[model samples]
Target: MAESKDLLQVLWSGADVLRGKMDANEYKTYLLGLIFYKYLSDSYLAKVYDLLNDETPDDLQEAQKQYEEVMKTEDAKDLLQELRESMHYTLEPDMTYVSILNDAKGNSFNREKLQAAFNRIQESDELFNGLFADVDLYSNRLGTGDQKQSATIAEVIKVLDGADLIHAKGDVLGNAYEYLIGQFASETGKKAGEFYTPHGPAQILCRIAMTGQENKRGLQVYDPCMGSGSLMLSCRNYSTEPDYIKYYGQELMPSTYNLARMNMFLHRVHPENQHLRNGDTLDADWPTDEETEFDVVTMNPPYSAKWSAAEGFKQDERFMDYGGKLAPKSKADYAFLLHGFYHLKQTGTMAIVLPHGVLFRGAAEGTIRETLLKNGSIYAVIGLPANMFYNTSIPTCIVVLKKHREGRDVLFIDASNLYEKEKKQNVMNEEHIDKVLELYNNRKSVDKLAYLASYEDIKANDFNLNIPRYVDTSEEEDEVDIKALTNSIKETNKAIKESNTALVDMLNNLTFSSSETETAINEFIEILKEV
Candidate 1:
């Protein structure tokens, strides 16, 4: 644990090397790209050292030297082939991060060499085609001219080279990477939503999605708007056979798509098990091949963003089943939900974070909510605290859906008031999350905290799923005692009247040198008596 902390400190300090040169959002590409490069190079060399045990020396420098020497021989061809098949990418002897760091120390570093290394990695496999596109080493944002750019890149490389990622455990390195991503998200503020979900809500979504699948084998989990793959990764924490769980996701942003891929690799998720794509999730349906439906689906899409919502979309299979009415072009919240729900298995569960407006809004959304409620697809609705997310402070809710559920009741939990206030955002502690999960699993009404509303009950409210309508979380006003309050006021007034009389007597007894002063004192006493 101490070693992991040290590694995280070293990696985080690399930001200082480029703090003023670029924003955290921009510099994140450079920093994360280099960390990924180091991880790849380290893993490659470590594997080679393990394979060439008798022939290679044990010392780090000596092992690297021997590995390079071996790579120059004809034997390197077979080793490269095996590595490519196993790791999905390969690095040349000179393309390793250690080699670049050694060159930088010798003042022989150039941005072109680093650029070429990135190009080589991209060309190595389809998964890595555009992996390094966001990291522009020669960009003026790093520095003004070629010399400055080269120097700045070299300095960042030096700072990262100090961290021993190869010696660290996979979870250690992955945790540090996640830590840096979170730090950058904090610095990035609202834009953080583009690629990251705050840990609190992410865990809640995961728990809700993985409720009954804890002991199941070969469980498949997916996220449609998989920002940085944090929510999908969180599901693995609860899985009994995490290694067997297949992960699938689609991200809209290219940079974030690359981050998700790197995040998966850093966490030691097998390349074959990870099926992440870079594209708009709602622009078109995905996974065109086999395995359309997933066992568990989770999403935290952009709240109420506009979409084409073209008339042609009514024919799309995902939307065609929802009657002729489509989600409004102005708000595509229901579009994202339907897309995810369409891909959920009959026995699967889905948990999505959405704006509160979807609950009671009439028009097209109301029709969709009514359809879902009648089918018993909406399982549980959990109201999270406001400001729990980095993007917007507006309170959001997580609607848990289970297809073909036997129960016709929908559980509503009002957890909006159950959060710890921070300096900037409200946070849901473990107790808060566990309390919600406990109520959800129990599936019982808990007075003001939770309510199990039947389909008949929801229909009575015209299919409005507003949480407050079901779970009354309103605090009771204190009861008042009018008679006691009136008596207290009368007693206080009597005390004031007695004090005024005493003051008047004192004023009358005092002798005043001037008639004006005596008149003023008498007038003051009269005013007190009137009060």
Candidate 2:
């Protein structure tokens, strides 16, 4: 744990080098993108060193030295081809990050060489095509002139060069990357919603959706709104076959989409298993042709975002099942839910985070709600504490659904009270998450914390899935003390009477200093007697 914190310190220090140069929303692209670039360069060198000497080197510089020596040999062409086949990309010795850092340390760095390395990585495979488009070394935000801009970038590289990403064990490096993303989210505030989800909710969402399918081989996962692919990537933690998990996702923003792509590679996901699209999830349906359904689906879409809600959508397969009704234009919460649900396999579990309004909203949303309830689609609703998100402080709920179920029974866990205030945000620590999961897995009612409502319970409320209707989170008022209360009031009245009598005596005994004071005292004494 201490080492992980140290790695995070080293990684975050790079952001400090560019803190004043641009906002986090912009600088995060440069810092994270460059960190990924260095990872790739160092990884390439390690692979080359292993292939050449049959043993990994102690450090990146050692690998770089051996690679430089090998490039002069006649067998270099064969070595490069083999590296391309195995790694799907090849970095020349001169273009490696270690080589570029050496140049920067010597005050002879060329920014163009770093840019060329980025371009080479992008060109080597379709998985990396246009990967670094968001990293603009020439952007004026870095500095005013060519020299200053290059120096600024060099400073960041020099800071990041200190972190030995290649030697970091387990998921330390990956967790460090996630830590940087979370820090950036903290800095960007509302805009952070575009590319990040707070870790607690993301963890619970994935865990609940993956409850029974943890050990399933080749588990297929999808997220309609895969912000930075964090939630989807979390499925690995709960899986016995972590590497066999395949990820499918879509995002509207190209830059965020680019971020998700980088996130996948940083986690070492295979290119073949990643099916991500850079497109609006609701504007159109994706993955329609190849493997449209998945074992687990999770999403934290923009809460109550507006969509077209066009008349044409009534016939769209994703929304058509809901009595030919579409979610309202002003609020697309239901729309996002249906899109993710439509892609869930029959045995799959789907979970989504949205505002509380969805459970009780009327009009078109009501129709969709009724259809979903009658179909036994919604499995459980977990109420999270308010202010758990970076963008919106409004409390949200995770609606866990299943396509085919034994009954229409729904488990309502009112975890709204299970959080601690951390600075300006509310956070759900492991204890809180474990409590909610305990209730969910138990599937039984707890007095005020959780309730398992039957289909009749839901129908009696007119199909309203409002949690408060089932689980009463309202605290039971403390019992009153009538006898003690009355005695206290009598004692208080006696005290006031004695005190007022003393006040009147003091006023009457006062030596009047002026005519005005004498008249005021006399009038007050007479008024006190009348009262």
Candidate 3:
């Protein structure tokens, strides 16, 4: 653990090397990509040393030396093939991050070598295609000229070279990567939403979605609008058989998609287990191949963002069940929800975060809500506190759904007041999250905190599904002690009258230093006498 902390400290210093000169979004690409490159290089050399010598080497430099010697031997081709089969990628000596860092130390580093290395990685495997597409070593933003850019890139590499990833465990490195992602999200503000989900809500989403499926082996989880794959990755923490868990996700933004790809690899997800894509999840339905539906589904799509919502979308299988209507063009919230919902197994649970508008907004959204409610798909609604997100302060809700559940009764939990006020944002700690889970498990009405509404209750409200309409968080006013309050007021007035009379008498005895003082004292005495 201490070693991991030190590694994190070493890794974060790379951010300091490029902090002031770069934007948070831009610098995160450089910082995370460089660190990821170091991980690959370090892990590669360590694996080679282990395979060749049957022992893990303590020093990466020594491993690199031995690896170079081996490449010149007759077994090199066999070693490369074994590497491709095991790690899904292979690195050349000249293209390795260790080699590049050594060159940086010798003042011989250049951008083209790093670019070649990136191209080699992309070419080495299908999983790594365009994996490092967002890292721009040649960008003018790095510096004013090519020489300066090379120097800047070299500086970043050196700053990240101290992490000792060869000795680090998977979770250690994965946690360090997650920490940097969170820091970037904090600094990037609104743009953060494109690639990151805040940790608090992420915990709630994963825990709720993985409640009963935690112990189940071979759990397949999918996220349609996965941001950085954090929400989907979060499910691993709740599982008893995490190694058997498979992940499927899609994201709209390419840069954000690339981040998710790197995030999956950093978390040590098996290449075969990571099924992610960079495409518009709503523009076209996906996962039309094998294993389309999953054991668990989660989403945090862009809230109320505009989509084409063309008439042609009515034919999309994901939306066709809703009486020939699609989500409106102005708000894609329901579009994303239905996309994830369509791919959920009958026994699986899904959790989605969106603005409060989705609960009560009439017209097309209302019709969709009614259909979902009548079908018993909407299971539970959890209201989160406002100012909880990096991008927007509007309070959001998590709508939990299960396909063909037994009843239309929905659990509504008003956790809006359940968070602690952290710096600039509201955070739900473990205690708060546990309370929510407890409420969900109990599935009973708690005064002002949660409510279990019957289908008739929701229908009476015209299928509004608004939490406040179901779970009234309003507190009843405390009964007034009128007689006791009157006596207290009389005693307070009596005390004030006694103090005022004493003050007036004291003022009358004071010898006036000037006519102005005498007049002021007289006016104050008159005011006090009236009081």
| Candidate 1 lDDT score at position 89 | 77
Give the range of the ten consecutive residues with the poorest summed lDDT in model 3: 166-175
- RMSD, each candidate, Å? 2.2, 1.2, 2.7
lDDT of 3 by residue, 384-403 (tens): 99999988989999999999
Q: Per-residue lDDT tens digits of candidate 1, residues 1-531?
A: 899989988898888898988789999988999889877877777777777784433445555786799988999999888778876777777877778888999999977777787888888888788888898887999888988889999998989877887678777888788889988988888989888888788888999899889988989888889988888988988998988889989999889999999999898898779899988888888987968999999999999999999989999998886657788999999999999999999989999999999999999888888888888899999999999888899999999998898967899998998899988788888998899889988989998899999888998999999999999877899999999999999999999999888988888899999999989998898898788
For candidate 3, give the lDDT of residue 178.
Answer: 84
Compose the digit string of candidate 2's lDDT tens values, residues 231-337.
99989889999889999999999988988988887888888889999998998899888999999999999999999999999989999988878999989999999
Clashes of each: 0, 0, 0
Candidate lDDT values, in order? 0.87, 0.91, 0.89
Q: Report the number of the highest-TM-score candidate.
A: 2
Q: Is candidate 1 or candidate 2 better by lDDT?
A: 2
Query: Can you tell me which runs of candidate 2 are displaced by over 4 Å?
Result: none
lDDT of 2: 0.91
Off by over 4 Å in 3: 487-531
